[model samples]
Target: MVVKSHKIHDVEMVEALKEARQKIFTEIRKVIIGQDQVIEELLISLLARGHCLLIGVPGLAKTLLISTLAKVLRLKFNRIQFTPDLMPSDITGTEIIEDDHSTGKKVFKFVKGPVFANIVLADEINRTPPKTQAALLQAMQEHEVTAAGTTYKLKEPFFVLATQNPIEQEGTYPLPEAQLDRFMFNLWVDYPSEQEEIQIVQYTTSAYSGQPQVVLDAEDITAFQDLVRRVPVATNVVDFAVKLVRMTRPNFDQSPKFVKDWIAWGAGPRASQYLILGAKTRCILDGRPTPEIEDIRAVAKPVLRHRLVTNFNAEAEGVDTIEIIERLLEKV
Candidate 1:
């Protein structure tokens, strides 16, 4: 009964957010030319309090989109450029000795790093070594950073929006599967259309500037995130999510043949959890009270893409991750 009351209250918030979504899109359009899908997924991930990973090449405005989002949402933003030589301390701050003027003695001080922000853009995350990448694991999962035996809570509404260059692998270290599973969405930022490209060139060649209005603040975002959790979902919708995740595993008894042939390792329980959360957020953004199977379908690709690891058979048959996921979706 208490859950029913929370859902009723959240419905009002969801209704109001319907307009905010349009306002946010309008504000973002000032600077961005296209990639509406990417923006929407990013918002879903942020509002659900989940981390996101974007796979794109250089010059795709991945950085601009995130920075513009931070501006529109009025959140603190930071960017860390990952490189081969980057160290863990660089991403998570290290302890330093300081002279205490009050006591005339030496003291240890922990200067926060770029990770101590509301929105963190981890640029070229794959370029760094595993050790450096591991620094983000705790922060992404726990929303807190532990250094020198002390754990510091990160700011509210915190999320790590990481980007990768898919075209480059010469010096890049692929993210460990453990780290990959931490992200709720693995979005692809494709090349812009011809018309969009022309518009992008036109905008950049001139003094045209786009300043998106501040849509929501930290408090509103935190409340909405709580509301997303409060939204109700049907039992069948939950079952579909769980079943979709299970079918990805090659060893499951009722798994699809293509999955057994192509997939090396399937997604775990986390995938199911994200599917529901993402679906809930999607319906709310569209002003719906509860999610349906179709809502789960819409979020399946991004949620499952990075989770499924293809095997040799998949490679020989020329079946990619997206194709495997699509075929599985067809069966359901």
Candidate 2:
């Protein structure tokens, strides 16, 4: 009887998840014209409780997409435009001295910054210097920020959706390796197609104004995140993910010659962890019971792209990380 009841619950949860996915897409489509893959990856990262880094040239609607997502999710959203002169205190709140009239004394109060929001969009994150950029590291990893020696827990289901302008790097500071690894997926938001561009122009140039309806709240997001954690993974799937990550390391015995020749540093264990977790999330999001190697393959590029560091020889030879990753995928 208990087993039967559990099975029934699982079915109900799956149905609810499927419905939620459709509802989310419907709401987002009202504002966004296309970029289906980008939307799917963003949803996967959200369900997996992971942060994302969006890379694209300007005017691609990267900021718009993230803001619209926050609206659909009905989370408190904050946008921090990172600048060169921005300080760490700008992102994370600082302490201010306050006068207490009743006690006739002054007390220091910790004022929260934009980082306290449920959905934080760090627009042009690379524009900030390293000191300002590192401000997000603690919040992303620990989910808590320390201000004036007092730790404050952020709201549940916190996410940092950072954007970077790929075409312009003249005055921007490149993110450090340690900080880059914190992101689960480094999604590239490409330009729209010819037809899609026409649609965008028609929609924007017209008097059409549409707002996305709220699809999910904090509780729903928390539940889905927990559900992603509960999703089952097969042994073979886990093995495949591990093997793929291992093959990226040049020093690993299982690594190929291309990795040793073109790659300077390989993905760390976090890549393997994200691969399996992302695969499991992708499986259930597609209404499957268990993850497969194909799911892992689908998430491999985004999960491993930012983690791999290419050598100077590769650049001289016009070789990129994608080529190395594709070769590894073929061999593994």
Candidate 3:
């Protein structure tokens, strides 16, 4: 009887998740035209409770997509524009001296910055210096900020969606490998299709502004994230994910000859972890009870793209990381 009851409950949850997924896409379409893959990946990352780094050229609607999703989430969203002169205090807040008028005494007060919010958009994150960029490291990993030797806890469901302009290398501070590895999915926002581009122009040029409805609150989102973790994976699926990550290392004996020749560095254990988590999230989002090998393959590109480093020979041969990943996917 207990097993039957559990099966019924799981069925209900799966149905509810499917309905919510459709509704979210419906609402997002009002503001965002096309880029269904991008939106789906964003939802997957959120469900996995992982941070995302969006890489694209200017005017690709990366910021707009994030803000639109924020509206639907009904979470406190803070947009921080990273610039050269921006200080760490600008993001993580600082201590300021203030006079306690009642006591006529000066006291130091901690001022929270944009990082205090539930959803933080680090716009043009590469424009800022490494010192200022490093400020986010603690928050992204720890979900809390240490100010004035005092640590303050962040609100639940804290997510950072940082954007980077890939075309412009001038005057931009490249994120170090360690920092880059912190992001679970380094998503690339591509330009819209020709028809989609026309639709975008028609909507933006006119006053046909979209009003997105709030579909899921923080509590509901938190529940979904928990549900993603609860989804089960087969032993073979887990082994496949682990092996795929290990095969990326050029030094690994199991790595292919092409990988050893074209790769400088391979993905770490975190990649394997995210591959499973992302696969679980993807499976649940599709209303599947158990993750399949296809789920892992679907998420491999975004999860491993930034983690793999190609050598100069690959670059000289006009090969990109994504191509190498595709070859790895085919072979592995």
Candidate 4:
């Protein structure tokens, strides 16, 4: 196959970006034994400048994967353990009155919280109340925070990798569809294989210790993100993505019969945009100059999982949103 070359400003820069991405992936694998697909999708989300929601049972190493990726990329990392009683001010900093000794006057200062980091691990996000969860809306959408009538921009290359427990719902507040729409991908982390499980047990039982190496600096990561945006997509591939998203809406005339009955809402335009950007990132990681249709298909589940909303009937029937997505893909 004759792959078309990327229209990067400097051709050599692409080579450097490829090397940096590979090195970071290598370092991440040192600590994370399995779930290579999850890691790759997470990387695609990062490069596409979108947030991710990781859903799985506990002890799947979701936190370890995000933290290790932060370490390998040499980015500031912070973890926020969400709880039902958590308040908005807890995640986004609060204003406190302080007495200035030098000026002899009182002033309100905003103390930064974990949300200001380059990489944030929102552990058990569903445990937090909706009020507290709203604190991340501005940061994820605008890359800025508004507190006490002041807007503070977050650091560049900011990425939120939030994890939620799928099995527990006792004290968990289900994420509102509006908030869930903010995420680019809803990655499902599953248990390891027999061989991988054996390796995990052995590695944990042993006393082996190794620190994560810094494979790429912040500048390089930002550059690669920009490159992902610039990657070219053919008209046909773009149309394919658009059609896939449109078919998810139950109200749409062209939607599949199952989707029309089961889905309450379909994915919006952002889904198509993220789908293209994610495919571009996936292609780059796979050493391809341009994205292919298979790349879009590979990422469809993660990209649309959270975006599509199912009706109560679908839920009562124990049908998943992914099944509706698959039906749409087949029709499209």
**Candidate 4: tens digits of C-alpha lDDT, residues 67-180:** 899888888999999987888888788899999999999999899888999998889988887778888766888898999889998998999988888888897888888888
Count clashing residue pairs in model 3.
Answer: 0
lDDT of 1 by residue, 1-332 (tens): 01232445666788877778888899999999999999999999998889999999899999999999999888999999999898888888999999999999999999999999999999999998888898987899999999999999999999899999888789888998989999999999999999999999999999998878888788777878888898999999999999999999999999998999999999999999999999999999999999999999999999999999999999998999999889889987
Model 3 earns a TM-score of: 0.96
Model 3 per-residue lDDT tens digits across residues 182-251: 9999999988999999999999999999999988888777777777777889999999999999999999
Between the candidate structures 2 and 4, which one is better when assessed by TM-score? 2
- TM-scores of the candidates in the order shown: 0.97, 0.96, 0.96, 0.93
Candidate 4 TM-score, true structure as reference: 0.93
Candidate of highest TM-score: 1
Worst 10 residues of 4 by lDDT: 1-10
Ranking by TM-score: 1, 2, 3, 4
Clashes of each: 0, 0, 0, 0
- Give the alpha-carbon lDDT of every model: 0.91, 0.89, 0.89, 0.85
Clashing pairs in 2: none
Model 1 spans with C-alpha error above 4 angstroms: 1-8
Candidate 3 residue runs with Cα over 4 Å from true position: 1-10
Candidate 1 global lDDT: 0.91
